[model samples]
Target: MSETVTLPRPDDWHLHLRDGAMLTAVAPESARHFGRAIIMPNLVPPVVTGADAAAYRDRIMAALPAGSRFTPLMTLYLTEETDPADVVAAHESGLVTAVKLYPAGATTNSASGVRDFTRVHGVLEAMAEAGVPLCVHGEVTDPEIDIFDREAVFIERVLDPIRHATPGLRVVMEHITTQDGVAYVREGGPDIAGTITAHHLVINRNHLLVGGIRPHYYCLPVAKREAHRLALRAAATGDCDRFFLGTDSAPHPDGAKESACGCAGCFTAPNALSIVAQVFEQEGALDRLEAFVSRNGPAFYGLPVNEDTLTLARQDAPVAYPDRIDAGGEDVTVFDPGFPLHWQVT
Candidate 1:
């Protein structure tokens, strides 16, 4: 017989609540499903300082619709010039939970990403001392390696070394997309943890190529083969304490997606939790869902688990995706948009 489980409310360890009108439009979807979220700092200009993080958090808070009890856990975007003192200041002010490291040119709005690992060693060392986490978009931005293999390469070439260099520093490999990434994070000891996105567990590379180029299926550290997807499901649902949920649910307007050069991201926030629940059920690990979504993230981040409670029932539901936000004429499609979701959040 299956057991019914009720657990502490979950937090999105990684999320992209873009600023401005998009922030107003998309913040509610995430807030409705999560008690708190670690908001991504990769905006157009990026949130590189503590003040920027605090201001962005206020914007996210304002965007949240009425009656929504969502807390935005902001992060600072790390750059080569990022002062180590700022890392300590941000943590001390309680404005940011972690410092996001996007290797230069790795993803959207990542132009200001750290140029070299050594450049930010000071910041990393400071985070180690402060007990703060360093959230990484773990993909090497080298031209030689095939796009699909960047995450795997980064694990061996960059992340491993960084881990060795900073012994006690806590690191979260955000939106892990490959089996190699999964294994590296799992075996790399307790100081290293990973955040798994909802889409990677449910969709594979074929989904993007099938039936023409599905732009909505596009995202950084792009989806991998079905075998990798299966591996991810196993790792996330498995007893590994290193894996947790981070729905890099980015919203791009339909226009940006339909252009000659399309942006890469999936607006999974609208249906993120349901997708995870469905994947867990399919993997025969539904009983472990609570830990993956709730306990593990906070435990890894050294934060108190929320007191709120949320329920996911095995029921059919539909999720809708708007072509664009009401405030702007932006154009892009969200992942799993307008689909019949198999799980419902209550």
Candidate 2:
């Protein structure tokens, strides 16, 4: 016998649909499962203004699969030179949903990110006044900080101070990977929330380095210790509304990922929901999956829950998913969870 579960259509609070051919190829994978996605703004040159966000949004809409109802919630990249007025206008015009802050040199395509947070005071203040959420890449790039310590260090040195200085400023800590991050969000008020990626809940650092270096499993604010992974799993499965789903399903071509210094990301968009279902089931929290994927994120962003629905059925046989997604001529490897998945979107 097969078992099936249905819930309101879900949304991805954090996603990276790169531009051009890559965008064209990968957009459909997300569209098939999610009703909306908070599209990242870290493209080449970055989307830094209302105008840039609008143009990028147009391109995303153009690339969406025909007849698909997938909406791309656009964001602006926060830079030292970013204009507060432009951000306000963008939000007012509904051209952008939030502003993204990538600490300079923190992750891929972040060369244009904010180097000195103090320089963007006015912009942050304006976003607060206008009620625009700031989605952050919560890791510091200081050479002295151990790579595993960046997220915790960022919370101490950067996140807390900014939230204190700018009251009422909504912030979403994107793709949190540590127990410190989960604890902070659990203690914070509604103005702050954290996004837990599908990959983070299933894998730990050992999966990336135990026997050999696995580039496909690598991502920024890279996976942490087993204890941290267990903490993340708990946060996502618990009844905490502060934590929600954000696949951070960034895709990099096989060539780019297999190189000596490969890019950092996991292309999990294709099977995010399926993998998430398996995790929730493993945790005996199937009843809470809808809140993590659909309800909490919409509440945080002040958006309406999707009216549609998605059904996942558990089969006797293992589920099968494509190993890679074609990005123009190159292939972007899909994240492999190393365990058989039995849930499939029906």
The top-ranked prediction according to TM-score is 2
| Candidate 2 to truth, TM | 0.99
Mind giving the per-residue lDDT tens digits that candidate 2 earns over 1-346?
2278899999999999999999999999999999999999999989998888889989999998789999999999999999999999999998899999999999999999988989999999999999999999999999999999999999999999999999999999999999999989999888999999999999999999999999999999799999999999999999899899999999999999999999999999989999999999999989999999999999999999999999999987999899987888999998999999999999
Candidate 2 weakest ten by summed lDDT: 1-10
All candidates: CA RMSD in angstroms?
1.9, 1.0
Candidate 1: Cα lDDT at 86: 81
Score candidate 1 by TM-score against the native: 0.95
Write the residue-wise lDDT of candidate 1 on 1-346 in tens digits.
Answer: 2434567888998888888888877888888889889989998788988888888888887888888888898898999999889879889888779999999999999999988789889889889999889999999999999998999999889888998899899899999988898888888888999999998888899998887898888899899999999888999999998899999988888777767888899988777887888778778888899999999998898888889898776644353344444435554355763346667776
Best lDDT goes to which candidate?
Answer: 2
The C-alpha stretches of model 1 lying farther than 4 A from their native spots are: 1-5, 316-332, 337-339
Candidate lDDT scores, in order, read 0.85, 0.94
lDDT for 233 in candidate 2 is 97
lDDT of 1 at 138: 93
